[model samples]
Target chain A: MIPVTIEQMSMRFGAVKVLHDVNLTVQAGECFGLIGESGSGKSTVLRCASLLQDGWRGRAMIGDTSVRDMSVAQRCRSLQMVFQDPYGSLHPRHSVRTVLSEPLKIHAIGDAPDRMRAALRDVGLPAEFLDRYPHQMSGGQRQRVAIARALILDPKVVFLDEPTSALDVSVQAEILNLLMRLRSEKGFTYIMVSHDLAVVDHMCERFAVMQHGRIVEVLDRDAITGAGAKTSYARELIGASLAYENAL
Target chain B: MDPILTVRDLSVHYPGAPVCAVKSVSFTLGRERLGIVGESGSGKSTVGRALMRLLPDAKLSAQTLTFEGVDLLAASERQMLRLRGARMSMILQDPKYSLNPIRRCGEQVAEGVRTHTRCSKKQARDKALAMLKAVQIRNPERVYDLYPHEISGGMGQRIMIAMMLLTDPDMVIADEPTSALDVTVRLQVLSILDDLVRRRGIGLIMISHDLNLVRNFCDRVLIMYDGRVVESIAAGQLDQAQHPYTRGLLAAQPRIGGGRGPLPVLKRDPAWSQPMEIPV
Candidate 1:
């Protein structure tokens, strides 16, 4: 069954259209990727699908229910998003315990502390870190806390926007491994948006390439890994990525 | 050929820090591209700054630091000022923050030329325009009058390059030069730098965290871990690096055809933090 779907989604801001007729769908337990450069409207699609932005024209369905028809609480329970910069995404003044438990408290879920501990453990962080603030943690540790917060609600679908772009390469690898492990263990669908072709190829099975607010091509793992993209823009992006690899 | 720059036992100590930010690091450079690859806090940027004497607050010491037979460690402020843009210059990461917000882009470039050489206003302006063209900026005349905020990030970076190379320095130290650029534009910027360096025989010190970029663009690579040079190898010989940190960094990156699997995280060893002998 399809867990997430977007049909002819469009967004405009002050006479400028950022997203035009974008469509996407993800099966249960699948990881779909959106790849593009800056100003490519990939983030707009995620925003509209997650119902974070209103006034977008289209149908975004999570299972059988449309996003627009869902209540705030229902949407909160169904979808979550992890932003690009963990440093800015997390609350600076809040402790890890408070940050994790706020979501459960808002949803009126019981055993908030236990669920918070479980979430921390799920992201491979120690329980003792619960008392520390965001400033006290390292970049990788802060990112782990961000991931823990996103998964605390146990949502059916999660949107990751350039999750590791701000991290060092070593820390990025650790985070990527953690994400892959959690997805397999929990069986949740993911829609990852990134500008890096190699990272998308690593984490996603099927991916779409966007350019100038339009979807230029949708490719499978084999096609992307083989650099067999059909469009000239996709080929150019791939070529640019490969040029660095073969720089010697 | 003799090296253009040489250093021995270079160290930098911040006032309140417990340990030296850059430990007894030493290297030599000729008229070729050399890369320093390291993670944040590994002191890669500090190395570049130490060469240029830009870290005023830090206590810098070296057994020997020489550039073109001149002692940089003993040079006075006034002498160093004359040598900065006239002989060597540094390129920072972002042009947006480096450029003056209120000044015209062409005037900034011409200012560097006028300060370094005896030239009339028209001559400096002409030289600035030619330098902008050399960096491959389309419509140089129109861009010269615009403010830094008026140009795109890529164009701003090109303008920064034009300004830095206006005096025709003998060496350049670029600290994460392309980190702010997109992939397509990054190639163009790098090629511009590459061409200028090749044609002018200017030594370049490229400091960045991207291992692949360093391996592809540089003739030699220095791998830094925890404020120490863990490994130094030729670009073609990067795969044969003996240090565990270098090997781990290479393995951590996700390749295109690499199938799904958990990337191996680097296991930090306390002994690796101690200084080691650098192999030639």
Candidate 2:
């Protein structure tokens, strides 16, 4: 069954239309890539899905709930988000236990302590990291905490925004592996936003290319082999990713 | 000819740290572009800062950091300040961080000229406009008056390049300069640097985390891991790098034309973080 459906989802902030007639669907347990350049409104769509912003005019159906039409508490159990910058995303003073357990506490998940510990282990984090603060841990460890917090709810859909951009190569590899494994085990649909083509090529099964507030091309993961794009903008992204090594 | 700059036994130690941020690392740069490639926590940036004598908050000591014959280590604050922009300049990684937000772009560029020369305010403004033109800013006159935030990221970087080049330093140390820019814009900036440095025969030290860019752009490559230089090879021989860390770095990247599933990840080694043993 289709897990999430977006129909003609157009978002405008005052006069600037960020997303225009955007339509997408995420299959259950499938990893979907949302690729775009900076200021291309990729993060805006993810924000709408995570229900962080409520002033959007769009048809966003997450699971059985109409997201655009829901109260915050009611939709809290269905989706959770992991932000890109782990340093800024997580509270510096908050313990890992507090950060993870707060989500469980909010969603009314039972046995908060046990659930938090289990979630940490499930995300490939050591049990010792529970009481540590974000600043004490490396970037990879903080990202894992963010993942654990998201998964503590057992949300049907997880929204990851540039999950591994701030990490080094080896650490990024470890996180990527953990993400792939977690998806298979938990069976949660993923809608991840990133500028890295290799990442999109690796983790995503189906992907959409965004340019200047519009979907230029949507392709399956298998179609990433070579020179094939109906739109020139899509071609440019592929070309840029291929030729110019993007900032990691 | 003697090396453009010969650095020996360079080390920068943070307060109360056991080891230096950079160990006894040594290298020499010539007239060609020398690319220093490394990741975060590596002493690559420290190397550049040590050469420029800008390592504030850290204790820096080098056996010898000779810019041609002048010793950067022995140079006084006033003397170094004079040489900084006029004799040698650096383009920082991000223009947003380096460029004065309060100052107009043209005024900033012209100030760079006025610091070294006896030029009048109007003459400095004209020189700044000419520098902008050299970087291919079409309407240099208009952009000169605008503050840092008003310009785009690429435009800001070009303006920075224009300002630095206006001083016409004998050598330039660019620390991850184009890494913040978009691909097309990055290539544009690289081409501009290439043109300016080559035409003027100025020595260039290009420090970046990107191996591919360094290989494609520089004349020589220095691969640094942790705090030491693992390998230094000619640009043409980059692919043939002998060191395992260098090979691993090359392998970690996904080539544009190569087919792939998942790209290979670099294996970390603890030894790379240790001090270097520089032979005499």
Candidate 3:
């Protein structure tokens, strides 16, 4: 397990500034959360850190090494991302074998067959799922395959961007539990971004609430569950979530 | 004090499909908010579409499906079209897919007014602007001209709500209306909807997958499983729901500061899928 850090990260798209001086430190094996409304640049933070997005004015560090200094292959081996939509994230044409084996093949890793089988097994899918296409699997199963592919490379840190948002509550519960079990079993650090405060409060140790491209408040589980948040925006969010009667 | 809508023994069967998508679903809606919730393919949205007569290919069979005392099942296509968007309307899930891509926001909202009522273009535009303002859009004039792509997701959803509420329909079926929106934005939209539902005294059927959203927003809740209503309970009393399915759904949710251990997965019982003994 390794710590991930972002320093003064700022990003812009044309005239619109999407992220603003976002500084965060996630200690080793910590499951940190980023919460906010839509367009709050939560996903942008993940993209910037995961190297999917560049040209942002900031530095991202994973462990002792700077992210910018690492090669594409090196970054893949260190950290991976699981997207929100299981339907769209997985390639429709690719079989489970291809999806799992591609990363290993790209990194020139040996033992593709055994590794692919083990990856599927890790996510609670049977070995027979390796031959199935994305179309053949259910939404929850597809998400598990996506999670398996992310862990196939055995990345130390995993970026989960609204992983359970698209799923049903029952399926969401199962996925969340699977994620927690995997984290504890493998000792992998997680950075999850979700709009559901309940999910964040359940999974995260500490979380940052973002608004207007800025981190408005950083809160712990106690702040979420105990005395409530300090900022009005955070409080308003909490109140709104608690019940519709409390909504402004 | 008549109910706005009454549904009895509604079933939907797709052609060549072995089983019906919706089976023997029944409910009655007064001038109150009713939430229909379940997992994907549980047929919550199917129930909504069957009520609207939107599913053309699917064979819909209902013993009694009436809205505002009009028989929805027996109504002719032309008659149903007139009743739709005037007395009853449906708010779709995604504004991105629902809103007209090529049309301006104001024009789309105005089109609904013109379609349902005899109004001049100027009158429709004025009413559309008024509706947009009611939805809490900051600058109706500025947003009026903006296309669907130009507006944000929250703004787009609000605009969609404005369009749906433009005709002052008696009953509105919002199917996952706020699922596409952010949490804060979702509550804002729901409050706007809540205000309209109370002030206008219109019945609302909110179809969603989120239990917390339904628990807080709706007065009553129906838990559907595999094309059947497994349990129907009051929103506030969801905690003490009777059915195993209802209890499973309630327990499955990860409450903020509730539990630290791995969440309990729903162990589905075969009996939950069997026909329920209809409550009086």
Q: Estimated TM-score per prediction? A: 0.97, 0.93, 0.95
In model 1, what lDDT does residue A203 have?
Answer: 95
Count of clashes in candidate 2:
0
True contacts kept of each: 0.67, 0.17, 0.79
- Arrange candidates by lDDT, descending: 3, 1, 2
DockQ by candidate, in order: 0.71, 0.35, 0.58
Task: List the candidate numbers ranked by DockQ, top first.
Answer: 1, 3, 2
lDDT of prediction 2: 0.82
List of clashing residue pairs for candidate 1:
none
Query: How far out, in Å, is residue A124 in model 1?
Result: 0.9
Structure candidate 2, residue pairs in collision: none
**Judged by DockQ cut-offs, is candidate 3 incorrect, acceptable, medium or high?**
medium
lDDT of 1 by residue, A1-248 (tens): 23888899999998999989988888888999998887889988998888778888989999899988999988888888989999999999999999998999999999988899899999999999999999999999999999999999988888999999888889989999999998898887899998777788899999998988899998897885576799999888878877866665
Runs in model 1 deviating more than 4 A are: none
Q: Model 2: how far is A155 from its true place, Å?
A: 1.7
Candidate 3 lDDT, A91-163, residue by residue in tens: 9999999899899988999999989888888899999999999999999999999999999999999999999
Report the C-alpha lDDT of model 3 over B1-280, residue by residue, as the tens digit: 5788989999999999999999999989999999999999999999999889999999999899999878998999999989888888999999999999999999999999999888899999999999999999999999999999999888888898889888999999999988988776787788898898889988999999878788888999998999999888888888888988888887888887787788889998898889977572
Clashes of 3: 0
Q: What residue runs in model 3 are displaced by over 4 Å at the alpha carbon? A: A227-232, A243-248
lDDT-superior candidate, 1 or 3: 3
